[model samples]
Target: MSRESGTATAEATPIHAQVSNLRPRDLLSKEDCLEMFRQVYLARYFDVRLIKEKKRGRLKGTLYSSHNQEAILVGALFGLKPTDWISPIHRDMPAFFLKDLRGDWNRPDRIGMSIEEVCAQVWGRVDSPGRARDNWSHIGSRSKKIIHSTSMLAGTIPVAAGLMYADRLNGGDAVCITFNGEGSTAQGIFHEAINYAAVHKLPVVTVVENNQWAYGTPFELGCATPDVADRAKGFGIPGLIADGQDVFDVYDKVMMAVEHARSGKGPSIVECKTFRAYGHGDHDDDRANKYRPQEEIIAGRARDPIGVCRQTLLDLGYISAAEATTYHAEGKNASEATNEDFPPEVVDYLNAGIEFALQSPLPAAEEGAMWVFKENN
Candidate 1:
């Protein structure tokens, strides 16, 4: 679908740009500021561990790590309330973890997911919440209202639309948000979903994680528009771009979009301009394909979300160098630890979860076929 650069139909109108230079205090409390850093570190460390597991052959099938794209997911999810629904992409486990933490405000007694549960899911053992029914990254929790993503790119955009549409029909204030890569934005589903959302005034927030490349293909070859958000004008909805590397920017823009939806104003698209540090998945090598330049990767790594956030905290005197190092080691094992920061006990707990999954039995084959409907018992 070639995106036309012009105004939307009569129903569409320009959504005002929120280019606020949000200060840390403006968006986060002292605890929030520190927790944000912890979440970034957790995402980075978890990804690194997954890569190691894949290399060691402990993890089967493909591995999609959101190594450098933590800020986008973390920031976006932070803006959403517990009642709001989310449809996550394959590389969006971090978002699920964050969502669980928020829990249902109405049911404040609900416990969020522990790090151990995430470890089990990544391992895809019998102990995983998916119960070996799905592969890694195709994660969902109905209790948490997260739509498990399918392997097809942009396949779930319409699903998010459906969820939001159903919510609107029920006179509910909930919004549904879906995550997609820049490459997926080129697909027909992306256009159809946005158009439907705009026409029906569905409270759906389509977050385009514009990580410069759609797998091996660069954004330039895949998308004609300079900014994916620019395509929003055609739909007559608000389109905003934010620095995906900067958590505050992502949080600020997404918060505004959430507000717009909750106020019954319709959909908004947010394009987070960021880079994917890994090569598509664990199997592909960007270096071998020469998909991205080594210099560019190095430069992007320099602006690592974890590092930038850590430094921000340090500069603001929110955390000392020693405390930051400790936070970095939270999810990593002792062998993986560096710079004298011993791995935290959570590492042992995660490993235990992995072992539990490994020791558990796979689901019965008959049980899988049983879920299908039958005319008669």
Candidate 2:
């Protein structure tokens, strides 16, 4: 992954010759690669299961499918430390559980939210980390270092910057990673937050999941530059472009940016070129199909993240061809894919979460107004 400077190009060009000498992915052992593959499957399974639940009318709220964008969440979070901070938006619900989930999926002490908690949030039960006070993807845990996000896109960037600033003041060296869609780049808060982080040299890595269409508007109509990372040039920061379909590429690019920030090099913008596999949310499915060309949709989802990761593992000799065909979850939507299409562990994991969510109780009626104001001593 090349470190980009000036206008962000469609292709990455190495800014320093030494960068090509070794990549973050090169150091990964076979076990690590296998874990990454499993994580991808886990993310896909989570999204698929939720879509199924929503359709069954068991789960309320709009379901934002992270269908093809699994790689961005798994890869970006795989290399992050438990102490690191992250802010995931509506499209990134899987990220809540994927963070700090590299080795142990059931570790009680992990910094990431448990699958049960995420499921509880979706079910609007009190078991959610936020106690079901907020709706979908709006919950966060300060202890876990996940920033709470609102509907306002790119609004969390400044929050991330402020969090890291306070951490630095307290002699902490934590880097904050905030996720956003391509359309959020046009928001005034996006520019304002990045400018503040840049001026202060704060360790904030802004990840732009450039899924071709931001809701109904296409990328071309929203931004002038071919690459959203080009906007980073104005702040004099490194903007990197990664193949969002390839998990390894995303990991490499994000790790590079992480290292830069950890070394006190300030902030970076990692533009991951991926496509939204489905409608922005389940509610827009019919409209999305009508507005987006069938050819464009087909082209965007051509390279499924799970398929890409599987091929990488095959090339590295980590998995045999037979193993690759054992579970063919890729290219199949939630309705088309079944539990048998995923690994037993992945299926069981989500099953347990859903079961727990179903059993969890809803918050008391009076709880809604409890957190509205903080009482003074």
Candidate 3:
């Protein structure tokens, strides 16, 4: 030991301190961490499996997975009930599954989904409530009276607002949640949704998953504003920010925002800062390499949301290491078993969804030929 001979060395900043402002709680419990870890793991596993299948040419088209960005997707859905409705974009599948539909349950068929579910795709089977077939989207809340499906970017924002409006009109006590990517904030539709929701004082919560990418372009390149939440002020709505990686933080912020909207205080915009682990799609052969730097991707992996939450859970004694191991294994086994359950109808449903668009009569050739805006005509 040094006796006044050597000066004390300074230690690097602690991670908890570095992110003090981002968190929404004093301390995270082990169970909180474990739950977040499990949620993120399920989401990541699904994405990874799909990507693997795509690489093997098993998948016919793009699989927009939220691999690294699990925190935002699952975190916000924490403490959510089945009755609450959610609107999402394609990339937000984990949230959709955990919130709306259960891909986990394994029935005898194990092929997953029934012809009845398939028949609802955009064409609306007689048994279907919507009556139009093509209902495969994410999120299903039975307790919160929620809806399940994703909208195009800011497209769902307005739809969510409408749901809240309907609730208010019908004197319903439920809430509406809509999620989108950071880039969607730049779209005019996002503003309109917020404006109308705020003006009407609807019970809607708009969440933006800021993972720094929209399609091939990096978020920084596409988003003009430094903080997307700041845009909420223009609509006279409050803006909340949270650590998406930490599921607890997401839960806290979302719950608070939902309460604010439900009480007739208008809507809120929550920007969850997160990182995207996988590419926008499974196939990278034709990716726009100009965007998404590999260095950035490597740097982001250091703070895995699932790992962080697991550590917190361990610290809180919510779950033991052995239990975690078993938990994870069980989740994987369940997933493997689930794939078998989804047979012809699962694929058929997807196929039928596309067919709904295709089967619709094409624009009449004669009409197209006759309806041109030519000066000669």
Candidate 4:
């Protein structure tokens, strides 16, 4: 579905009354704040670029843009130690940048993919770890402990439980973070996984990004509960709802959950109340789409995640307005210049990646023959 980049005009910009007085320093250190801003900016730019590429017919497959939910992924992941594990769905692409990978699974906070790699991966380049084997969003690094996601609804929930169980067997204290949407909560697997995790006290955090709509269905129509977090009580585990638009609230709640799980507490559920700010994908025309109302879309844009974080950073005297503006520009310009010569490194990396992906041979015909499994014949 075709959709416009719901950027608010000066006169149309909604004043965010949701900004809280909680200081960033009180919750995050100086380094954490800086990294948070960098990832948020990068994710925003990456999202915008993906939209543009889809419009231009460059990116293939479904384009589920994480236009507004950057804070939830960033905040939840920032609190994770490198030794911890995370499993992300299609829209949680920004999370790939929060870690540092050094081929050492024992190391904490492994580095994530570079912007060029993410862009190339989305573009379906062979250089991507997926090797163009599937949709670009399915990328997972074994060394980094990122489990590749499937397109199935709530499919990974059970797999996340398995990871936690294995970790428990190995006597590791790391937690497993998995993401799902409000709609997925309706699926049977979601309930089964949560029930098992709760019974076992598995170290896993189930983050439900309640972006109000599950595909074309609104949360109200799909579920009777007031909030998705309430489902946690049924599982007998702690559940909390956080302002998905606010980074501090998300980070705070997720950190608390992580601590709880690390201390041998059962899994917890965190429902982030936010909006998708885009059609389900580029294939759905949001303007003509009857399922999602225009008024709700407009209202969602007013509480932009990046804008909220910028105002909070300024209010806390952590960063100047100029610095905030610069951060955005850096993210946007870097994304725009990936093909241009201005940023030689980015251009070079992207070009080489694109060339390798495009020129690389498709999987050989015989390669599939090797993966065959035979049951004692």
The per-prediction tally of clashing pairs is: 1, 1, 38, 14
Q: Estimate each model's TM-score.
A: 0.84, 0.95, 0.68, 0.80
Candidate 1 lDDT score at position 12: 22
Best-to-worst TM-score order: 2, 1, 4, 3
TM-score of 2: 0.95
lDDT of 1 by residue, 35-76 (tens): 776666656656666666776777777877787788888788
Candidate 3 on 134-195: residue-level lDDT in tens? 34344333333445554456877787788778767887776777888888888888888889
Candidate 4 residue lDDT tens string, 171-220: 88888889888899999999999999989988888888988877788788
**Rank order (by lDDT, best first):** 2, 1, 4, 3
- Worst 10-residue stretch by lDDT in candidate 4? 6-15
Candidates' C-alpha lDDT: 0.71, 0.90, 0.59, 0.69
Residue 11's lDDT in candidate 3? 17
Model 4, 78: alpha-carbon shift in Å?
0.9
| Residues forming the 10-long window of minimal summed lDDT in candidate 2 | 5-14
Candidate 2 lDDT by residue in tens digits, 1-377: 13432224322323232556667888889999999999999999999999888889898888888999999999899999999999999999999999899887998899999999999999999999999988899999999889999999999999999998999999998999999999999999999999999999899999999998989999989999878888988988888888998899999888878888887878999999889988989999989998999988999999999999999999999999999999989999999999999999999999999999999999999998897878888
- In terms of TM-score, how similar is model 1 to the real structure? 0.84
Which one is best on TM-score?
2
Report lDDT (Cα) of residue 57, candidate 2. 88
